[model samples]
Target: MRRSIVAAVVGVTALALTGCAGGGDGSGGGAVEKATIAIAADPGSLNPITNATQAGQEVSAYLYETLMSFAHGKDAEGLLAESWTESTTEVSFVLKEGIVCTDGSELTASDVKASFDYAADPETASPYSGVYFPAEGLTVEADDASRTVTFTSAQPQSFLLSNIGQMPVVCAAGIEDPASLDSTPVGTGIYTLEDSSPGQTYTLALRDDYTWGPGDVTSDTEGLPKTVELEVVDTEPTRANMLLSSEINVAEVGGTDRDRLESGDLFTIDVPARPGLMFFNQSEGRPTNDLLVREGIAGGIDRDEVASVSTGGRGELMTSLVSSFTAVCVGADATTSLIGFDADAAAASLDEAGWTVGADGVREKDGAKLELTFVYPSTEAQSVVAGIELIQQQLGEIGVEVTPAPSSSYTDVIFQGGDWDLIWAPISTTLPSTWAGILSGPFPPDGGNWTYNTNQEFFDLTAEAQQLAGEDSCDAWTAAQASAIGNLEVMPFAESTSTLYGAGVEFEVTTNGLLIPTSLRG
Candidate 1:
């Protein structure tokens, strides 16, 4: 996943040292003072129910609490829910005792139910609406006396625990007035939002009463920073410079700057994720709407070269939509489902699709030229920019005129459907069920299906997989994933390991690239 550069921050030199103080919370003798972490951009919304962006989720991990989490890339552990029971159609969780929200309200089962209900509502227009839970047929019930929240689905949903458990839960205060969550956070998290300057900096203070953390960790854990400052630093070189000067505690530096960070004695955390994914707009009159044209575009470029160039020679050829870090079905590769590279076949496919080479050396069909608008995120690493240019040159060899469309606001292009024929966007997930919602169902403004492409076969297979439990559905999931790749709904060609460098802090990141606030240490 790429980060968003909302705006460049001026006077960052002063913001780096804004909250560096000697006095601590007096818990653990104040060994750890404060932490200043550098993120690439502004976390659009502090509201967990409304925001699903990578930067937003990273910041929310501290401000919002989840029912359960995959601890340090391991199995799911209880945080809010002490225990849970699950079946094919229904699952219920028992909330832990003595949990309190930021506003001195006791966290209850009703709060959890309200949070899920609001997020699942289509009127809310959450980016994670269907991605988190099925938007159509979900019934949530809360028993306040027993402190239990029950979710009953109309049909069997696979990975129900993994999918819904990781959702950020909000308090009743935020649920009644959703607008307040956009800037102010209200949850029973380990940290509370103290102050925030959009696109510039965010100040968070640790909760002294917070005892329900991932696994056995708590706020009293040694080396837990009393105050955390998330500073928006957009450039890799600038973040690297801050790390060297001890201005920031942690920052992710990819590309050439990673070399210098590696040379230093800094702590590093790596998570495997797909960084290069290609999707064609199959809406209506686009050239990519035709199967043969999509196949031609697939065969024209060398995937191995694209993977190498895009990740600075630090990526592997992707196998499926799911990342390698996924715990359920590890080592599931669907590379065989996609069309391999062959320049001759690529040109032949275009010719068979009624496209003829014009005098200008560009393909033409019915007075329409085979010109495509390729969109990619501009804030990506320099290597990614070079890789997109390489793709342009490779497709040109087969008489396809490619226009590179770079944008700093890539999410807007994704959700709003800008004037683009093809897009390079990486959709990372731990469960295949999430991909099912993204690939199928309603498109754009209505749901998570942003590509405007659908494969009924893929949807049917995934529905079948959803009925089975845990590892028992691995075969169905593999076939479902292969079906999407075989039909060319989307293509995942390269996988990059996301690296986070820490100067004076040590922490572990979840498989989905979220930092574990409880795992932080000095």
Candidate 2:
């Protein structure tokens, strides 16, 4: 619910994505022909907190390990944290002991403490650490010989286990210079960052000593590749060319180009989960304050059309504010089902509120045009274009004028005080508990969501949910879920599905889900 706009989760360099006209023939995966994979986009700063950019998250996944990981089960091929234990209230982790950084330091409890502390500290300015570590006792007291960090939170949070699974734990010592850690990842995963020439490419070397990997890596020993590399192939056409010419081993191809990648002999199309959505401003005094109007907008958009503009031509329409993984979303489809692709119903509801379409073809009443200038962060060209266009089409049908305002460097602008109507941006969150820490906590007048869409009722519910320490607190959390979605303040969209293109090769490769590169073999 933070106002930080994102045009789309589009890549920067070689990982150009465009949906193909049809589904892939499904024959491109096998035998791991190449270890090096190229993607598009120059990853911003390597710092996990500073690197809010898409590439930063991608590389961060490669170089860091967390107490737990989100990419597990069928989706996550496996990475750090072998398994975990959950009580009604707290989930404890038995670390993936013996994992070490390139600096040769064995992964330990103290390192976990340092990494967790680094994220929570306001000084580090991590855009998202608050979501995972919500408790006070983040200290790591380890058994000198055991090499395991027993991670315990203040309460029993069902989503806490998932949150830690994706967080990248860093070595406080190795990162004496944060810039170095950012430029190169010295992780316990299969691959370590070797070199990065911004705007062109990035390269990685397979860590032969990598002992720990995702659970399903299925290695006899510490199986790995001779080397691994990532390229930042900037444009879509350029990335497709690289794939066809075998200039790169794997890449991401979406939209129309998706057809070419699926049709080409060079690469196999990998579909990770791609979630699309529109985020409403939570600032006070906005029309979003009107629950009916909010519901009307939520019910207005045609998710099928929105999905059509996205990468795979197929996207799961979200009815809840949270993704399908969260508990609140599990049993609460009742609230969500009320709002989905019903422009006729939306129009009727708006008419009840005296909002009539004006001569300009925009809705209006009380002298205000239904025209709302929709804003989104100009992070990437493809994302900006797709997000704005789809939103425009969806809202335009309801006599809503959505003007696309694009800005390449608008991180501050998006979060800053604005006169915006609606914006599309997702704050990266690993757990639902983060709802309290990021959304309600910072998005109002006093916090980061300076959009003025404050709702005290929503904030109090979030606070109440945070204090309860275990799964027993599900009742409170479920309430928060209903309040968030039912209130229609921030509309839920999609979980960004990232993709990976690869040649006939053997390794656990994917776009957005989970990664276990170290366990992969050439």
Candidate 3:
């Protein structure tokens, strides 16, 4: 679930990364002839539901197949179901027949039951079980001939295909034996788990005769990569350095090191990151709680320039929470669609709010200067430095003096209780319709809700959107995004992108939003 992988603080700096010429143990082509991919963050847990990080979900996708997979923008295809008929309140999925698990038994209705049963089982400790098997009556019943799985939600769920699409089917084989699951995962996907060393690395071997994964999944029919290896390397520079040195092929490069790699011929840049941010301290009674201040801050920072500099010039401005291509983002009117850099309007808004520039050049109101210490993590993208610099300049024009307080322990400092004016942090990797599913849905009540939406309207509408599904639900998602932006509770920047460089010229690599290591070749 992209939900739990909250966007960690992105550090902005001006250091160059190691080019492809450095950081390798040159054992030669005959020594290590496999594609090795390194990642900066630890892939939290092997258990899909519990582990929310991309690294974890990336590998889990290899062993688990949801009922339906997505192509560019539509439901592509997947195991368990070929097509689906969706209504406001209910969704019926027609399962694909003849798909066999690696254990050699064909998948059936009972296996679906066991899959959810294991996840819902408290012993499995699957954090994601609630997303799929949450309701009391939510059930997956298999029909004898067509193998249709029928689901009944007490209320209408606008995005059933999307909701169920997130569920990863587990084979009965893994369910029966818990001990073997850790060593050898048995699933109906195209690859089986080969070996994994905790806190170090994991490798997957492809199934030449296997089928039943998303048809649009990266591999080609004629030939596929023989094996996949994932090396656990969390340091930001180390990831970029490894990629440059040809020690690893792919990496989630930090924003700061982007220039170093882009200057060379070895790497390619992906999408610029779109992060959700808390604009002001509602807890403070000063101007930050004021909507005008929040809007000024949002208007103050130039998103395009940040993308260009921090990403080695590979990025696009973000207007909606879910990008325009996603099902949920199309109808959103709450967010800013026309994103750009504007310092004049930002300062004017602050001026209109009664803040005057003092001799020291900082804005002041009732003897207090408009100064804030923004907190960000040190390992965040180099974009952070550019963004912060732009923000300081823009806010200075508005009479607000912004300071940067860098820390690696951003989670504890920011979330625990800190006296900071603004914080740019991400709420989730997966942009779900309801953020509450990730940290705390914005709609749910505070006491009952674990993650607070901070903005009341967004929190309420997220619930409304969840129950609405389809065209109407899609529209609601748009509205919810609007509420988030219009209220200036959080300003979203850009969509996140990754560049995967390989150390060995052995295999072809592709990703369907999930990291499947089985695609690396000899």
Candidate 4:
């Protein structure tokens, strides 16, 4: 078991979030016309194509509409596209008739084609391009008369339908004028962006004409809030307090606040996630580049303690990087092959690797001190700090000096290849294919492989997995994951339930943790 800091940070905006007093409370008093929710960060940009942050995704959940709905089951349901047929290298979608954009323009297949084409363009530089749309050799065609959109990829992608279907589609107008979409959203979602106050608040108004929701859902569904107010509340305790007071309808509360929130009459929607994971920098010259040092560090630390302390004993020890919501193959126990805690073995490993304890009690190798910079996200709960400190002491006992670096710009540090030996950032995704690219692809500046992993066995297994569809690829993916875990390329330590506490609100969250706007009822 291992635990590290968050790779992402809270958004740029900061605003005081206060709940309503009487009428808006969740106690079934007066009309439930409005729903106020607390968002941890202020989404800097409203453009769905460019921003992929948690705050952005939350906001976009109301403003943008995807081709298909992401559900807990293995298959994806239709949203924008009524029906879709997919093959290894090709996918075709038929637009549902009567689907209209916020501007009252009928959503045509041409709009879908334009959106994909724009996102696929290199000049657009959308981070989601390769993940949602194929990064290379993607061809799209549309027939407005037939309401059909066809896509063909150069390489065979097993999960093409689910991947491409989930990409938020911009309206034709937004596609033509990308600059106009910077702060304003133009899609066919169930809600429209009513107003935005940059770092303060955001307002979304429900659309009365939105009848073509996922499955048989319609705008007239009971409990759907007429209006949604998103307020930036950085503190988890503050958000929890607001929820308890009925000042806010919904808020995500973590750490010790969860126990208090659960004791109340409020409803909870739990989003399963891997919150504490450790990634070692394998780039040249980094101390962690040495396999023996990684093994030494892994052996010295008690992962069970890290998980318990970090999550206030609310987290379960994770066996894999894939979270429960999106894990298609759950029986694979690759984590069992990872190095376990053994202090004696840790010391032996360090000594055999030529690191000797110096007068200061710090190890020295090649006349250089065995010191490392440990980085983590600055916005994590207080419990996470305690967990990090525990790791520092455990490593210190093994003669390794660990300097804790809490950063607000954790993603930037990882992307720019800053000075870090180990980092804590949980990777959350809807597919196993995503894990492969994140762990073994081209290193940063070229791609998202932050650790600079060069595991040939992992790469080969992942390649084999990508060629097969559905459960047929599970064996290969699990093998690939085991290879990475056994090599200590990354360490998944703790998993937690991200509870969204709601007072008067009733809602269901997607597998990856975004609140399904259509499911919001108050």
Q: Whose TM-score is greatest here?
A: 1
Report the Cα lDDT for candidate 4: 0.78
- Tens digit of lDDT per residue, candidate 4, span 51-120? 7777888898898888988754324689888888999789999999999899888899999988888877
Please report the TM-score between candidate 2 and the true structure: 0.74
| lDDT score for candidate 1 against the true structure | 0.79
* Superposed Cα RMSD, model 1: 7.0
lDDT of each: 0.79, 0.55, 0.56, 0.78
Candidate 1 deviant stretches above 4 angstroms: 1-30
How many clashes in each structure? 0, 58, 35, 4
Candidate 1 per-residue lDDT over residues 1-522, each given as its tens digit: 111211101111101101111113212223558999998878787888777776788899988888887754356778899999988678899999889999999999999999988997877777766677777788999999999999998979888878888899999999999999999889998999998899899999988988878767777878889999999998889999998898998888777786766556566655654368888888878888888998999999898998899988877787767766666666666668788899999999999999889999999999999999999876678888788899999999999999989877677887776788888886778777788778877777776677787678888898999899888888889899898887777877777766676666666666576678887777
- Give the per-residue lDDT digits (tens) of candidate 3, residues 101-149: 8788877767766776676665565545445444334656667477777
Indicate whether candidate 1 or candidate 2 has the larger TM-score. Answer: 1
> lDDT, candidate 3, residue 506?
25
Instruction: Report clash pairs, candidate 1.
Output: none
TM-score against native, each model: 0.92, 0.74, 0.67, 0.88
Error of 2 at 365 (Å): 8.6
